[model samples]
Structure formats: C-alpha cells, structure tokens
Target: MVYRGPYRVRVEEKPDPRIEHPNDAVVRVARAAICGSDLHLYHGMMPDTRVGHTFGHEFIGVVEEVGSSVQNLQVGDKVMVPFNIFCGSCFFCARGLFSNCHNVNPNATAVGAIYGYSHTTGGYDGGQAEMVRVPFADVGPSVIPDWLDDEDALLMTDALATAYFGAQLAEIREGDTVAVLGAGPIGLYAARSAWLMGAGRVVVIDQLPERLEKARTFAHAETINYNEVPDVVLEMKLQTDGLGFDAVIDAVGAEADGNLVQHLTSARFKLQGGSPIALNWAIDGARKGGVISVMGAYGPMFSAVKFGDALNKGLTLRMNQCPVKRQWPRLLEHIQNGYFKPSDIVTHRIPLEHIAEAYHLFSSKLDGCIKPVIIPDAS
Candidate 1:
C-alpha cells in the first residue's frame, strides 16, 4: 500500500523488498507504530511526499534475510528499526550523532535520512508494508533482548530516544526541577526520562485530564490542568517556591502555542512586546540560567527569537531530531534494567486495516488515544 496524497491509501501489489546493497537486509515487520509525526505525512502537510512513499518509522520486526556483507545481524533476529538510517562509521556517527550521519544520505547534508518520508530523507520505503527493505542494516537495526516483548521495545526506536534526548538537552541532575509542557505520549515519556535522570520533581502541563492523570500515575509527575487553572505559570511557580523550573521542555510544539508560550514567558518580561509570541513565550518561560529543550517538529522557517534576553539570562536552547544511536544503548539499559516502562505510554492498539479509524480517533482525541501502536498484521 502507498499513500497517493492526504487521506488516501491504496493497496498495490509489488515485488517483495530484497537486499539491494551489501549493507541492506530485509525484515518482516512484526509490529509498527503511527507516530505523531506521521500525522503530518498523513495530512499531506509534509513538503515532498509522493504517491509511492511507504508511511511509518517506529517499527519492530524479525530479520527474515541478511545481506552477504552484513556482519552483526543474522536471520531470525528480532530488531527495532531506528527512525534515521545511518552508517555507524560516518563522521557524525563516530561522535554518537547518528541523526547527522554523512553517508546515509549522500545527497543531503543531514546526518541521516528517515524512512517513508520525503526525498529530503532519502525516499526510502517505510515498514508499513509486510516487508521492508532496510538499508545500512548494521546501523539502522538494534537487536531486541530475548526477554523484552515487542510493544515494550517499540519505543526504543523513536519516542524513547526522543524523550531521552529531551532529558539530555535539559542537562538535568539530581534534585533539579523540570517541567514538561505536554502530557501526550512524548511528554509522558519526557516526564519518565526526567524522573530517571533524577529530577526531584517533574511537572506536566496539559489541557487533557485523562492524559494528565496518566502522567501523574505512571510517570509519578505532578500534573497541571491548563484549563482548570486560571494561571498555569503561577501554579508552577507556587509549586517550585517562586523560582521557576531549572528545565522546561516544550513537547507541545506549535499546537498549544498560545498557552505554551504564555506559561514560558509570563514570569520574566512584563512588557507586552508584540514580537512573535511563541518565541517570546519560550524566552519568558525559562528562568535565569535555565535550559529549554524543544523536541517538537517545526517547519523549515525562521521565527523571531529573543537572543538578547537569552544571552543576558545565560539560557541554553537546544533543538533537533533525536539521535537514536546515541541514546539507544542507554534507553535499552533503562528498559531492560527495570528502571523504565516506555510501553506503558501506549494507550491504544489497532490493526493496520483500522489505521484510518485510529487516525480519526487519535486526531480527534477520542477513545483516550495517547500513542496508539499500529499492529500492521494483527489478526
């Protein structure tokens, strides 16, 4: 099946994918996920999607075949696919930055290209199909532990890595105060990561009560209902003893731009400057010398930033796609060592045939959707 355009899915009979390069391997996709990022691709919002591009990144599968040159992976191995495909020995990958690998996408300067995305990402097919062709197999796939279930390992590829990246960007430490700006799947994982990173308190902000409640129960984070509370920032300050959090992560991105920025900027700048409000809010939210890590996907465009304020306050801002290779080892350790349960973030599970229904439910916030993992072949 291929997506011709927004809201369109067509099943097409095609030759089974096989290893085209020595580094390539073929995998039978056992479990695949529909990431929030996939929503953009589904809605035709991605800039360069075409008719035949397969759509999906988060997937776990069994290695059905391996290329002759493949060294580590073997047939019958169960693996998790990294979102970004990269060569492990590339200049960037050597530095634990697989997201910017030089060899994965020779045509692009990015470290690596993602599967099932636009030409900007190498135009490689995705794992939404029954079988997927994995390029740079040694670098793209990670062997799953024999004891771990597929659902538990699914997030190790994307969301878990992203949440870990958020925590790393925050530079969190023991007793540090951290606040996550959303309670969605990513936000919940961010909260969990913050907790694992030894934050004394993890505060989650969102308008959804069910999500907030889940965060409070599973991630052990304090929850704030943005709607019920008249002033979210004030509530945060009150909880943190009038000093703002040491780290604030904007997981909500542009969707909750209005309130996200308000909570971020209301504490510092009293002047009503009409500058691009999102930037202002981000700047305002950070306490002096605080860290702001933005993991949300933003379009390729420029927004006004308060560089002067950031400089004066000594704030550190970091943003980018998650580097899976860098964080995979640690995340796997966390999962295997009994310190984290990333799978608990999944609130819904549906078969691939019901993908459209899943999309509707997730997009409409119905059925308590909070990261539904799509089982492509589940009967």
Candidate 2:
C-alpha cells in the first residue's frame, strides 16, 4: 500500500524488505490490520507522511529471514510484531517505557520509532506489504502462541494492546463508573477491558447508531448517542447521579464528531493539531479529581483544549503511544481465560488490492466497518 495524499491510498508494487542491520530480520506478513491511527496517515493528519509510504502499524507474520546477530528468532517462526520499534536496553525501555525508547528513533525524546508511519516516527516501511523488515528483532517481535487465532494476534499488535493500556491508565477502582468517548475499536476494547479491571458500569458515547449498538453488544456497556442527548456531559452527570463518572476515556482523537467548529478548525483546516472535543468532553463528564485516560492519536501541533478547566477540576491525565509488547502477557492471559475476544470487533476483511475501497468504506464509516483487516496475499 502506498499513500498518494489525503484520502488517497492504493496497492503498489514495492521492493521486498531486507535485513538492513545486524539486529534486523525480515518477516513475510501473514496478517495486517488497518488501525484507527492508520486513518490519521490516510487523511494527511500526521506530519511528514510521505508519498509512497505504506501505512500499517498492526501486523503479524512469519519470520522469512534474519540477520547475523538476530538470535531470538529463526526463519519460519510465527511472530506478532509490536507497533513500537524499540531497543530493549534503552533508558526508557529499561524502565519498561518501550514507547519512549531512546535507541530507535532519532526523535526519541518525543516518541519511539514506529513501522509504516511517516518520517516523524523512524521512517521505517510498514508491514502492509507481502514482507517487512523487523528492526531490533529480539526486542519487539513476540512469537505468536499456537493457540491464538491469527486475527486475534494481528489486533494485539496495536488495538487490543492500546485499549488494555488505556483502561489500565484510568485506574478504575471496583464499582467505579467509567465513561468511554467514541465507539471505535479502541473505545470498544477499553470498555470491555474496564469490566475486567472491576469497573461497575461502562458507558460508551457515539453518534453512529451501528457503533452505539456495537458498544452495547460487544463491549456490554450502556450506550449514549450524543445526537439523541441534548447535552452529552449533562447526560453523563445524570447517569452517575449528577456527580459525573468516576473516570473517562477519550478514545476519539483528531476525527471526533459533535463539535462542528472544532472539527472544521482542526480536521478540515489543519489549523490545530487535532480535535480536542473528546478530551474536553472527558474532562467535563468526569467527577472532580477523576482520572482521564487518553488513547487517541493526535499530531504534534496546537489543539484548542480546556487546560484551565482540567487543572481546576484536579483531573489526572494519562496518555502515551501504547507500549504494545508490555501489555501482551496480561492480555494473553485474558484471551486464554476467554474474557476478551479481539476478533469479535473485526467487521471487514479486505484484500490489499482493494485497500483503497477499504479506506473509503472506513473513512466514510459505511457498511458498519468498526475494524477492517487487510489481507496482503488475498489478491
């Protein structure tokens, strides 16, 4: 897949990746996913998203080759690569902050390298193709458990992991009422994960009827169509007896609905980094001193946000590019226990050749595409 420009992506022939360094390996992609974050690149939201760039951060594959120094993996090993490209021994990685690895990205002070993202990350090609080069092979790629479904393993590379991380950041206590903004993939997973973390009630907010229904069925959470409610924040307060939710998760980033002015200024004009509507809603919809967990992707630009309101409310804000590998062990256990099934949310599986159509369907939010998996070889 090659990025032409905003809303322009197509399948293109590209050179198969090779081991460029002693620490690198090459993997034949078995499964790849179109993440909500990928839409940021598809829509020209991220800075330096170059033309001819492949746009995938969630993929699992079989190790096709390995460099001289790559010892942990061998050819034919099935692996699920974490979206974060990090060297395990870096200062941040030493503290288990793999997303901030200092050794991978030259812009390490900001965030670690990521596959198939723009030059703002590490400029590494992504795994949306038939093959991808795996850097720091021993650190980021985990061999997929034999029992794990391929579709499930693909989601763990980013979506499920990030959602699980978001829920963890919320610090949900037993019986706490949690509100999730957006009924997208991450929001859905965060809602389900909240239950595993002992949240008493989870409410998902979205304007789309299909997504709202998905929130109720897949996440097992109460649904609130913002379109139906006169005021979303007030409705949240009313649901929680006027005190507001104990915690809130802003799972909609950049492309959030509800506020036309913010959407136009941020998403349309590129005047701001990304929409802050969801973040602001999370702030106003939570109780005093309630925690806000943000898992949404935003560009590194100015976004008009309610900082003063957040500070005055004494809110605890936590966010990061998810350290995907860090959450796998617990998530794997959750999967084994049948508490979560990541594949349940997968609504479409389009081949790489039809990726343009996939992007169009997802971008338009048509055909109930909550999540779409990309099949590289299906064409």
Poorest 10 consecutive residues of model 1 by lDDT? 266-275
> What is candidate 2's lDDT per residue for 181-254, written digit by digit as tens?
88899999999999999999999998889999999999999999987878888999999999889999988877
Worst ten in a row by lDDT for model 2: 264-273
Question: How close is each model in CA RMSD to the real structure?
Answer: 4.7, 2.4
- What tens-digit string does per-residue lDDT give for candidate 1 at 1-379? 5787776665566689988999899999888887776765665555677887887888889999998899989999999988988888867888878788787775578436888876677788887778899998887788988878788788878887897899889899899999888788888889988987889988888778889999998888988786776666677677777767889887755342222234234332321112233344455566788988887654332345678987988889887788876787777778779888778878888887776677667766787888888776886
Question: What is residue 80's positional error in candidate 2, in angstroms?
Answer: 0.4
- lDDT agreement of model 2 with the native: 0.88
The Cα error of candidate 2 at residue 33, in Å, is: 0.8
TM-score of candidate 2 versus the correct structure, residues matched by position: 0.96
Stretches of model 1 off by over 4 angstroms after superposition: 9-14, 231-235, 254-280, 301-303
